[model samples]
Target: MIEVRRFKKRFGSKEVHRGVSFHVEQGECLGLIGGSGSGKSVLLRSLIGLEKADSGSIVIEGQDITQMTERELIGIRKKVAYAFQGGALFDSMTVFDNLAYPLREHTDLKESDIKKKIRDLLFEFGLADSENLFPGSLSGGMQKRVGLARAIILNPDTILYDEPTAGLDPFNTRKISEMILRLKAKKKTGILVTHDMPVAFEVCDRIALLVHGNLDIIAKPKEIQQDALHPISIFAHGDIT
Candidate 1:
């Protein structure tokens, strides 16, 4: 559903993405794993036009987003939802309002329908009672669940996750992984950018290791595990000494 080819991005004298290329098929969750400063987040931003690439093509379902204008991108953004690392919930909005914001902005669904949708999502994410609470009142795990619930409330075809399990406890991390797996079962495409190796192995159908601004290896979890000498193995499992 998504294709990136020869993608290159730079920050002044520093280059972030150098000819990086990869694809995520429909119903597949591809994990993007990399060390610090590897530009994984920047690549995710570029997919949504939050960051412009210097030269390359990012095509989603046959449309090249690299050349799309802000107006043109509105439609694409609806089909591609991004779940930010820190939840990114509106501090001023209540949890219910935050969850309803996208539907109110993007769809003509009636207020009643919107409410139903929000309630269903909250229940699905195990947050049925959090609607009235503010983001600050929630725990880190609750906030992450709320962020994910908001991201999928619109039923976008593609979901881009940035550090979904960054600071959560093991239980919450497992919850996040289960959520990703649930999304995959429903045939949603996803690109998960995370440093959590266990989450990657548990949820992603394929894992792509980013090294030196490009995908050094893309393989299934078992393949990655079997190839001890592969760069991904080295990075994910450490030097097997």
Candidate 2:
């Protein structure tokens, strides 16, 4: 459902993405694993047109987003949702309002309908009681769940997750992992940018290792795990020897 070809991005003298390329098929979750400063998050932002690429194509369902105008991208944004790493919630808004914000802005649904949608999503994400709470009141894991809940509140065709399981305990990490798997079960297309290898292996149908601003390897979890001597595997395992 998403294809990136020969993508390149730069900031001043630094090149963030140098001819990076990858694809995520419909109903497939592709994990993008890379170290800090590898441009994984930037690539995710570029997918939804939040970060414009210097060159190359980012095609979603055959539309080249790189060439689209901001007005034109509004429709694409509805089809592709991004869940930010730090829960990016509006500190002033309650959780219900935060989840309802997208629907209220993007759809013509009535207030009652919007409330229903928010209630359902809260229940789905185990945030039913969190509707009245603010981001500061929640735990790290709860905040992450709320972030994810807001991302899918629109029922987008594709979801881009940036460090979904970051900074969470093992229990919460497992919950987030299971939530991702549940999304996969329902045939959701996703690109997961995470440093959590176990979560990546557990949830991704294919894993893409980004190295030196490019995709160094793209393979199934087992394929990657079995080749411990491979550069990507070694990097993932932190075994430089």
Candidate 3:
């Protein structure tokens, strides 16, 4: 489980997140929704210690990470994986190399064990045959799959997805949504940052809508569709409040 209590973040003079708080239960897939610059991404970053919070606390499982030293945070970060926006794959390396990079750096596993893990991950991502291909050679959707394979290579307890379905056609977008559902079934807690309502409704177990640097609502998808508090649902679906 994770908790964000009265979190606040600032950049220069701009306060990105102001007094934001929420909780994600273990094995829960929570969607963070908001328009651009609404602080959804900032919140995700803060939760994983990628971005420091100027005030408030982010506790994961019971550890308050707001004041942890860099060395202390490293161990905590290993259990949290992040799938960045646009599936940021290494353009120079082959898919196999990209996926193997994490295990090489983080774990003391032997070469054979690493190879076996990489093979399994590639197979799971449906890119077993494309392991030798560079990111440039594969299509955008394939690249995204490789990126996801790499992120899960460490088998992190919690995964943070930043715009997982951006820049894809409807077909690829749905594929990623299905992947999110599959990940949830595996008991991986997911924090998805996206503005796509349909994707949220399909994949997320719960949705938290951010408006004006605060969480407007956190409810089940069915409740969100029925409730009238979320302004984005009104504009995105033309539902009367």
> lDDT for every model?
0.91, 0.91, 0.84
Q: Which model is ahead, 2 or 3, in terms of lDDT?
A: 2
**Model 2: residue 53 alpha-carbon error in angstroms:** 0.5
Model 3, range 89-113, lDDT digits (tens) per residue? 9998988889888889899999899
What is candidate 2's lDDT per residue for 120-211, written digit by digit as tens?
88888888888999899999899889999989888888999999999999988988898888988989999999999889989999998888
Choose 2 or 3, whichever is better by TM-score.
2
Q: What TM-score do all the candidates reach, one by one?
A: 0.97, 0.96, 0.92
Model 3: residues with Cα > 4 Å off, grouped in runs: 228-232, 238-241
Task: Provide the lDDT at 206 for model 3.
Answer: 90
Q: What is the C-alpha RMSD of each candidate to the true structure, in Å?
A: 1.6, 1.4, 2.2
Clashing pairs in 1: none
Output the lDDT of residue 91, model 3: 90
A best-first ranking of the candidates according to their lDDT comes to 1, 2, 3
Q: What's the lDDT for residue 226 in model 3?
A: 83
State the local distance difference test value for candidate 2.
Answer: 0.91
Clashing pairs in 3: none
Better candidate by TM-score, 1 or 3:
1
lDDT of candidate 1 over 43-110, digit per residue (tens) = 99899999988999999999999999999999899999999998999999999999999999989999
